[model samples]
Target: MFQPTGQKRLTNVSVIRYKRGRKRFEIACYPSTVLSYRAGHLKDLSEVLQVDEVFENVSKGKVAASGDLRECFGTTDRAKIIRQILERGELQVSERERQYGLRNSLQEIANIIAAKTVSRATQRPIPVGLVYKALQEAHFSVQPTRSVKAQALEAIRLLQQHSELDLERARMRLRVHVPAQHDAKRLQERLVQIETDAAKKAKRGEVGSAAQVAAGASVRGGSDTSASLQMVQVESEEWLTGGALLWTLQIDPGWFRTLEQIVAEETHGSGTVEVISLRVLHEGDHLNDVL
Candidate 1:
């Protein structure tokens, strides 16, 4: 005969994606089922829930005997339900629903216990065994000692310490390695060599001399007067104090012709023009600033 077998309520249910391809498909299953399958190849979890509930009620004096508890589950043997519930908790509820439902059930049980019954001389709180039984029936594992606040605080502290250490280590490793002074000296020497080679090239007419190339020292007319002469060098400290100056100039065609004539007269058939100090100066100062 069918008695008042415990009613089944679906606590949680959701569709899970099983596979995806050209054709996508999903399946609906309870988290308890998945967890149980992973833990062991056990089946028939609903029976477990019924048996646990009956056993719990009987244990709490709500039921008279094992037969009565079995009758409650509409079965002669309650062992089957008990074993199922022990092996696997509630399968009817999804993870989400089970979580909320379990909490709510606990709270309700706490309230009911608080309202009823009185204590003796000491006046202690009446324990709600039924509430605990209900949770066990629902496959909710209750820990006697669980502190959410404490766990959260511990996690936060650990994360903060780790982050601080990481930042400090990074800062310590940051360093800019400057080039050696010897390297700088070598570079300067190379530059001087390049300038000397350039000067030799200028003498061979392969390149223009510094005097001919100095800026603001271009010839004005076809005349070769002292006033029209190019300043080759400046010996004043005022010009050399800041730094060396190098520059270039473009001579007028007429001035160039006159200068060539003057040089021809002075050298008198000397096939090559000999270059002395080839520096072009402007107002007792060199033309360009060298870094």
Candidate 2:
């Protein structure tokens, strides 16, 4: 529901590199715009009818000069500037369609650079030379400090070699853990119970015994001989068996919460729903057909 004014211009761009004990600030540009007027002639009398007899055209153009760098220094020096540039550049690239009107390829490059810089900053276990090489491969310039470069390379190597571990760590940071096998097994048992109990109550006129329910018999209330004598068949089909397991897992509290969040965010609303679990044992083939 938010809209941009479309009048904002790029400003305060800068770049830098560090080497030994010194820092080097490089040229950067922040683009601005201005309106320009150009002369043209009407080719026909009809053109005059659509506008003033003397027509003027206006064109938009960039007003900022090229190659200007803003300086940053001390403990917060070249590395810091590079980090800031990478972050801001990525943000601009992501919203480029609405910001600078850049292409997808350009945005991808920006993202890669940002990711590499952040990776290097956070984990510095690799050699500087390798980090520099990796950055060059990814089309990023390296800092002058040998220490920084070594750290960057170490981070890159770890990222490249143990991507799965890196991904697991990231997921852990987000507090997303996979459910254990035992938890899944318990959920499956609960599912079977709920299903068997509901089925017995449906088919019989009296409440069936616990053992009967576990054996997949429908409960019948009272001592009506005719109803009690009727046997309810439980299905043994593969599809039904598989579906029971699936249904059980689907209704798990963690699974349900995740699904609910996904649905709510997608629909942009808050709604409520009830989930139930069940369990049942094998009797005949009635469940297969009914399921």
Candidate 3:
């Protein structure tokens, strides 16, 4: 066990990049106490703490874990965060949710329940029995908790009302094929108008930003058609004499459905949006590159 020498306060926390391209994050405290995790675990840790990146202690002050964990310079917080991340990662959406699809709220709730269950469990390799016990204790109903599969499905259905976590996921790049009936000039005008409205929505705090709203529109079909928009840039536009015009949009997943809907509406049901590729955006993915 890693022991603490003196007081418990965040001393140093930094992300270590290895020569072979491996990365690790280490959180330290006064004296020599430290907690470390692999790069893959960083996402969950950051999500639990609501931080984007583990900064070097010199630039910004060291961040203590929230609540009780802040006072202790031990592995408790690190282990708990890692365990939750692992459990949530292990969860897979039910075949039914995959086939019939889950409502957005359900998906969010499912994620929360998974995180909470893993965090609450006392034993390692958290057993299905313990999961049921936790859910029952917390009054989180997952019908037929006898089996893991049944429990997961039930949890997804019942947990749709839990607290939300703002975590960034992968972004999808789309090729919106517009009908030839909409000329290049007309398409440009519509795109501009769409983005203009996005800016207005951002100014009103209806969305993350003008960019998020504009980009969200291209991916999800623009939920708030007149207001919300994501910050996405048109990668390229290719035109053929009589064929459809292919316009590429790179956007985050949060507004993907909205983007698809808006495009269909804009094209008057004549246009179609197809995902060309998906990628997780990194800090290096600058606005200029995306735009």
Candidate 4:
């Protein structure tokens, strides 16, 4: 805490941008800095005013020698923002609460407000920019939050798009070793279901089959269901006589891991789940021969 004499009163105002580019207003007048007073007893000039309080004091013209700070911005909107703060306090939705990164502040208030408003109005996410229209309809004009909300919504859209592609690109080839005591009937049923699902997806243009590799460079081929199925023997002495199976599965990588875990758990940790190959699909690769 730095002290100033009565004749040399000093006032310092600092604006800091924090998480999600939210602004935090801090004012240090004569006694203490905004963050310093929270540390308990120190010096005479140690009482700090946080931004929310600053908003109230500044709006009322209470603090002495704050004319310059007061004149820096339009008073009309400041009164509205302060009023909204006093009325709404902070935007909070219990049902929309997440277990992680819960925040309460003015910085992301617009984003939260827009997201909630859109979700409530349409039961889905609308563009963040559109939130301004909704706010306008509600007679609430907060421009900063509108811009922040729009950016946040755009970021969310990009994340969702990337995640969908990641899921589509997670296909893999599993080389599984069957236990000697494993039931043959169950394995056949599982294989049949896998082939059926593959054919369905292929028909929908959702994936390409390795069986079409030699016929063309791309996955597009004739309606031969056999194109998605391939088998090879494991070069192990124990699996020399049809004891092992190698099959390619086109699925999200996470699903494959989950399936592997289930198999391991069911087999009392005796089953083998080996990834023979993992493919990163591109536009052309899906149509080309099996890698």
- Which candidate gets the maximum TM-score versus the true structure? 3
lDDT of 1 by residue, 148-183 (tens): 333322322232244221110000001111133333
RMSD of each: 35.3, 25.4, 21.0, 16.3
The TM-score measured for candidate 4 stands at 0.29
- Flag the better candidate by lDDT, 2 or 3: 3
Worst 10 residues of 4 by lDDT: 211-220
Give the alpha carbon lDDT tens digit for every residue of 1-291 in model 3.
Answer: 553432233322322211111322223222111122223434434443323322223123343334323333234465654343333222223455433333333334444434333221121123344434444444653332144445554453343224222122334567878876454446556656766776677667686642444333333333332232344546666776686677777665445666676677777777788877655233333422221
TM-score, per-candidate, Cα-based: 0.16, 0.16, 0.33, 0.29
Q: In candidate 2, where is summed lDDT lowest over 10 consecutive residues?
A: 167-176
lDDT of 4 at 242: 48
- The Cα error of candidate 4 at residue 223, in Å, is 16
* Candidate 3 lowest-lDDT run of ten: 29-38
Sort by lDDT, best first.
Answer: 3, 4, 1, 2
Model 2 TM-score (2 dp):
0.16
**Candidates sorted by TM-score, best first:** 3, 4, 2, 1
